[model samples]
Target: MPGITSPPLPAPDLIDIHCHQLSGSDHRQILSRDVHELASHPIAALDRIEALLTNRRYLSLGMHPWFIKHQTIETAFLRLKSCTHHPKILAIGECGLDKCIDTPMSVQIEVFSRQVQLSEELGKPLIIHCVRAFAELLQLKKSLAPTQPWIMHGFTGKPALAAQLIQHDCYISFGKALLQTGSQATLALQAIPLEQLFLETDAAGVSIDTIYAAAAKIRGIDPINLRRQIHSNFINVFFND
Candidate 1:
């Protein structure tokens, strides 16, 4: 043991609220990191749950509006409901309105509503994936008056939209888009409070570490402080323990 010493332990990092690398090619790499991530995928793919659990990471399940044609509403609802009680599945979604998609709005609404209801009934937060349908999403939120938290993932909307979401007590997550110079996401990130903010990589190639650093710069705060706040937010909204 002469002239030898063990390496110090690593510290924990920010929580990636939404990502798709759970069971994908990069799953092992993500697991080896110090950060935590909420793995998102279709409810139909419950078989992938095991991989997410292996690292004790977070999970968000939903029937994305873009892939509605793949299954009947009944089947999707059933699959989602089956996983609602899983201990590691902290949230329900990646589900929300998407105006640009070819799927009929009515059908999308129906599936989205059921998922929202499931989130409400199970007392879990939602990881939304809204796209050009903020109005409809807000309307649904108004109609439901849910108490559980709802986080909009991959938000690159205007600052006003970010303000509106915060006013409604909905959190907004900034992803790789925030790193783009002069982007709307950058503006919104500046306007959003540290409490209502989250950083994610989504399915993008960017790392959470980079996203957190960029977010910290946009808000003009220390990266460590930003990481601490988001980690607190994650526990406050998801763990509640």
Candidate 2:
């Protein structure tokens, strides 16, 4: 209801594919919201989302695996479903398998699977959050064969893993890790095809422009070119539908 009547913002030069906090400036972004956070206080969370949509902010909504408690799943998922029809809700994620979390792998898989179905049904991209569960994630992708894009956000994996996910048609998004010397993200960014790549700040508390500059330096290209390529990637994935 909010974004439906509001005018869309101009195309952004720099796109932050996934982040928790919204920047004050008019940078393009997919602001992520975990449904777990909405379970206990649904009205408050939905109100916040409405305010964001009213302001013409794009959103990605999903249930993060780490916070998947059995009691809250129904409530959280219903809230997630309610928000998906909003035009400004661009993706269905920041969700997926995380092997290190205390939540059982079985539970994580089930919750993530539901979100996967929702994404496919709505024809929206999925922004994933994976940790030490590449094998399981890949297998699920293979089995499901979703038509929508799945972006691996905040990636810190090695080049081999990055290539494997790209091969599986997943876009890789680099974050603050790219700023570190000799980091896996920095190295992998150099190898990833520009079309299959994206950049984000996630919850790193850094400017997206800073990440773009660091990534451009690593890939031996001008920051303007990197920004342009990522803007193209963002349109292909987020607006293709």
Candidate 3:
């Protein structure tokens, strides 16, 4: 398979905390690619990571619960662990619990726990993907007490959920859902503390700029100020600088 490719671009003040497909925008993005997608070709996975990093791109690698298989978990996780040390690999997930998936909750917990441990061991933050599993997810967070930040990406939950997660020190990221008027995401975006928030495109195929614009409008702020605030949150969470 072809490795991920992108041309060199100037460093962006605006940031996309998580995305699957690369966009043709100038802003910085942390691409979220599953390690399991290339499990059979470890070299290709490494090469893709290398190419992205070589071109000043960033990414987060993880084994998503939806793709978790008893047969492939070990091999895929080994592959994921091998690449965690790279500086450009900013976070350890897109991984978390999902009650909607057919995968057993026990198995999901085991895999997600492993990644959580890995993230802690490596001192990297997490980009989380959660669906209808907040209870279990919050339990894990309380028990683990991980020092690194856990960003709940692509959140479309109500303001209460966003507030709960923020109270626990987890950052919430909004995506294409923000563009939809009267969406839970839009309402939550308005209520979320600016410092504990982020923006993304996920696999939505929308431009990060569009997401930012929608988010700014919902929060009654200029796009440029929104960009600056999110960029600041990005640095504080990912780089701790």
Candidate 4:
């Protein structure tokens, strides 16, 4: 860890629109691959991450698909449902479809559909975790189309896909992959209207502050200015005010 620079000062009022902090699939995904490098204690990880959030405060919670097999839907929902009332648990998810997994698409759909309904009822924005099932996912959304907002976390499709999702009135979260030079994902992000765009580090182990800096570069704006715009993007998507 020596020689590693500390996280930059957080954006002045910037929101980390998507992140995973619960003891579920995404957590185990990170820990199992590199358990020694990942944060061991949830409380300390939150505090360490919050230390970078000088001008913002909020985090999302969820049990991702890879862990869904670890618990019954009822048990998983019961645990996740209870966390909604906690202060700082600003959103619910990083949850949704994953067609590539052995888990039946039916089970994924069931859990995802239930979460969407509950999100609507609880009035919390939902951060999604979609893979190759965009069409099916969109159909599901159109059915309920919750009054609450839904953000597609870690979006990496072509501009056409981005256009399709944005047209549905769902927000998108761009990440480090989009910051790569001359990549399709990078171009796709460049094509996203500033208003419809948000940023994330996903499971990449990169800091959002770094991701934001790279995003500013991609958008040809100062970090401070991008901070303001992304703040607006966050509010437009999640803020009821």
Candidate 5:
């Protein structure tokens, strides 16, 4: 085993805009429990994410919808409020609606609305989560002021859905679904404008670079250039300093 290694390929440049790297401990505990598929999982990545950001790589952080069950909703809100000021914390979620999970729709709405209020108050974007709940999320967006930016991460439904979100001024972040062969999200990917789009890994069993590679192929551009565009998109979507 002493020499059993192959040459390492260059790491593809990527910007995972909806990862869970900035949560307070209350949220970290759930990440520690849920993100087991990550080679190092959440705890180690917690330290790694801070370093990656300190080294000037990009990512966003929040309590994803799946973890909402582990703790009191009030405590999660408090944690989100407290962490939004960190220089690396560019957005207010990984929070929104998920129909695939059994977390109550009512609680999800409360948390989503609270986070939206926090985004407005803190002057950051909302990195949202939606499965089959896009209509409800859009309804909530209608009540917020027109100026607040909301970036929807892991978006992979359809071109019409993208059009609807784009019409409302919400940005969409694409992930693994677009990478899968012959998938509808891949078809949808062809329709989205680069300006209203972002990139993410979203706790999926894929690397940010792979997501970037798959996406750049769909965009017919080099991955490095795509990375820069996503970085620019991240800045524009979050509008955080």
Candidate 6:
């Protein structure tokens, strides 16, 4: 008689810290098998959020600073406040200061601060999108004294900036830029501790598997080890698993 066979275990899901593709679009086919993605939706996309929650997808919502330049802040804030407490909303941003944008810095600061307060009130983490305004963002994080984790998504900053953000207990997420040798993202990846690092695909067409491989190569470790460590970080930040 043949020996009894054992069933195979499920594959571990690769955690993508932030991705817009999974949220408001029909591009869901792009998601590879064995991926746990956090979809980020801006304030304008909130209209479809009820459907997202019905589907039980993990999400992050915020009023991005770019919208403040083109739209009314009052209406944006109203929409943002209404959907913040949704059970599927795991984080409160992709919102943060952006000095490079047309939106006045003061208005951006005002809007960003409110989102920070909302994240604090809800006890959810923040998915920060900062550009040329790290100092301001850092200052605000200090002043707010938030207890929840803040992940700076798509980080391509210098090692010093990465170190500073990590010092303040912020998690740094790297994306496609990790493929470029001698890039700031690569340097920062080398400097940051594994526990504080995350990998994201953001709006890029690249797969998270590609990102994991690049990161593991840069860190000189096996891809499985990197994936396991980041899986642990994802649980620590989002699920407390």
Which candidate has the top score in TM-score? 3
For residues 75-173, could you state the per-residue lDDT of candidate 4 as single tens digits?
656656654554455566767889878899898888888878777777778888899999999999888767877888888788898888878988887
Candidate 2 lDDT over 1-104, as tens digits, reads 55557675453468888889888656787889887767566667777776865343688888888678645777777888877877888999889998887899
Every candidate's CA RMSD: 6.6, 7.3, 8.3, 9.2, 9.5, 6.0
Q: What lDDT tens digits, residue by residue, belong to model 6 across residues 42-159? A: 4335545444543324677777776666556666666667667766777887788887788889888998888888888888888888999999989998998998999999999999
Each model's backbone clash number: 0, 0, 0, 0, 0, 0
lDDT scores of the candidates, listed in order: 0.76, 0.85, 0.85, 0.68, 0.67, 0.77
- What is the C-alpha local distance difference test score of candidate 3? 0.85
Candidate 2 TM-score to native: 0.90
Mind giving the per-residue lDDT tens digits that candidate 5 earns over 1-241?
5877887555333456665443322111112112222222344544564564543444445556788787666665555555556656666666789999999888888877877887778777777779999998888888765456888877878889988998898888788897788787787778878888777666676766677789889879877677667767755655555
Candidate 4 — what's its lDDT? 0.68
Model 3 pairs in collision: none
Of the candidates numbered 1 and 4, which has the greater TM-score value?
1
Model 4: residues with Cα > 4 Å off, grouped in runs: 1-11, 20-55
lDDT value, residue 203 of candidate 3: 87
What TM-score against the true fold does each predicted structure earn? 0.85, 0.90, 0.91, 0.78, 0.75, 0.83
RMSD from true fold, candidate 3: 8.3
TM-score (C-alpha, index-matched) for candidate 1 = 0.85
TM-score of 3: 0.91
The residue ranges of model 2 lying beyond 4 angstroms of the native Cα positions read 1-12, 40-44, 53-56
Angstrom error of the Cα, residue 230, model 2: value is 0.7
Candidate 2 clashing pairs, residues 3+ apart or interchain = none
Off by over 4 Å in 6: 1-11, 23-56
Candidate 1: worst 10 consecutive residues by lDDT?
A: 28-37
